[model samples]
Target: AQSVTQLDSQVPVFEEAPVELRCNYSSSVSVYLFWYVQYPNQGLQLLLKYLSGSTLVKGINGFEAEFNKSQTSFHLRKPSVHISDTAEYFCAVEVSTNAGKSTFGDGTTLTVKP
Candidate 1:
């Protein structure tokens, strides 16, 4: 089984501001990086992923991340944020080459104050 440390339980950000979510993981074999966003009482939506390509990967909603192999870190970042971006973010690590199992971070709630 794999594990992930979110580092921060919550992150408060103002409207139209920039934000970054910290994430660290521990694994013996290769792992997949993922960030998911969840609105109030909603399911998680894929923000971005770093599988096996470039270190820098971008996703929907102007979000991007860089996969660091040595540090075992995959941090999520966005230049600007909106009030609508207020949600709970989770960093997950997928283990198993074929059968993927997700181990998610506690959560980082981005409070985009209006």
Candidate 2:
């Protein structure tokens, strides 16, 4: 089984500041990592993923993550963040196989203030 852990339950950042969301996973076999964001009352949207190929993966909303197999970590980062970026972020993991289902972290609430 695969599981995800988000180091921080909440992150506070000022507008235009850089931010990083820590994500770690545990799996016996190769797995896929994903970062998702959910706005208030909105559905979760994929931010980034690491399935194969390059260890570094980029996704929507200026977010990027590096897949570290040795560390079993896939940390999400954005050089600059906007007020609109305030939302709940989740780290998820699934086995590499198509039959795998994602296991999500508790989620990190990103609050951007002026």
| Candidate 1 deviation (Cα RMSD) | 1.3
User: Could you give candidate 1's per-residue lDDT for residues 1-114 as a string of tens digits?
Assistant: 688999888889887889998999999889888999999999999999988979999999999999998998999999999888889999999886636568999988888897
| Model 1 steric clash total | 0
Pairs that collide in candidate 2 are none
User: lDDT of candidate 2?
Assistant: 0.93
Which pairs clash in model 1? none
Query: Candidate 2 clash total?
Result: 0
Candidate 1: where are CA atoms >4 Å away? none
lDDT of each: 0.90, 0.93
Listed per candidate, the RMSD to the true structure in angstroms reads 1.3, 1.1
Question: Model 2, 1-114: lDDT tens per residue?
Answer: 788899999999999999999999999998988899999999999998899999999999899999999999999999999999999999999887646588999999999999
